[model samples]
Target: MTFNPYLAGLKTNAAEPGKGSSGNIERPQAVGNIPWQTRPAELTAFEMTLADALQAMFRDGVETLPDIVARLNASTVQHPEGSWTEQNYQSLMNRLAAGASV
Candidate 1:
């Protein structure tokens, strides 16, 4: 499949891929063949953006916490406190997961 910006689901299209043939970019409904899951409404905007940035970092093979924090600091996505530290990363993850029953 061709690279599509809509496939990321960050942008909505009039008609998504496999739903029609408007000749616009084809946004696949799944990632790695798994159906896309809806994000929880409880997550704040900062959390959502942070999650996206972390997802991109993981896809690029940045696994270590320090490295991830460093990359996040270097990127435009600022942490809620202005910068990401290993400590804050852990704290935020814990906080985000605290209310998550799943």
Candidate 2:
């Protein structure tokens, strides 16, 4: 399992959309060139963790599969087998894309 810093303040099962402790703030619209994408109906725990890590990495200018794998390994996150390799990382990506948690 990975320890993602990004997930620290997020609840696994969050409140209904637009509801929050601060009281129903409006959700922001897509800005600039960022296109709005449809949300997945649900995600597994592993998907959530991976999404968090990937978002953080992208914000930090981390791109490319090899680099992503390296950063993931260096962080608290590890692939299911233990550590990450490019091949395994791609394999996992494929499985996840196919809607498989493993």
Candidate 3:
């Protein structure tokens, strides 16, 4: 959260700084962050980049997690963090499903 210069002063409108800091921690979307660990990143970019590929595969009638995993592993898609495993892919899907808008 400290990395975002834009969000430098975007703290809760606390009655007092020290006291307000005691509230439950919250964070904006952790999507396509550039200077990592900060404000809401460009989630749409992240989504569309991956979604486009997935959509194409689905349109081609690809189904099942195993198949998807195999295709992703074999495809030319390059995840910023590296290769995809079944577990990591499933976890990512879960994160996307949680609240990621189209």
RMSD of 1: 10.7
Cα error, candidate 3, residue 94 (Å): 1.2
Return the lDDT, model 3, position 88.
79
Query: In terms of lDDT, which candidate is strongest?
Result: 2
Q: What lDDT, from 0 to 1, does candidate 1 have?
A: 0.66
In Å, residue 42's CA in model 2 sits off its true spot by 2.4
Model 2: CA > 4 A from native: 1-41
Give the C-alpha miss distance for residue 19 in model 1, angstroms.
Answer: 31
Local accuracy of candidate 1 as per-residue lDDT tens digits, 3-99: 3333354555453444334566434563233233333234556766888999999999999988998999999888767677899878878876654
Give per-model TM-scores: 0.55, 0.57, 0.49
Q: Mark the regions of model 3 whose C-alpha exceeds 4 Å error after superposition.
A: 1-42, 100-102
Clashing residue pairs found in predicted model 3: none
In the order shown, the candidates' Cα RMSDs to the true structure are 10.7, 11.0, 9.7
**What's the residue-level lDDT of 62 in candidate 2?**
98
Q: Mind giving the per-residue lDDT tens digits that candidate 3 earns over 1-102?
A: 323443445555354333224563333342333364443334566566787879988998888888887787777775556887778787777866564333
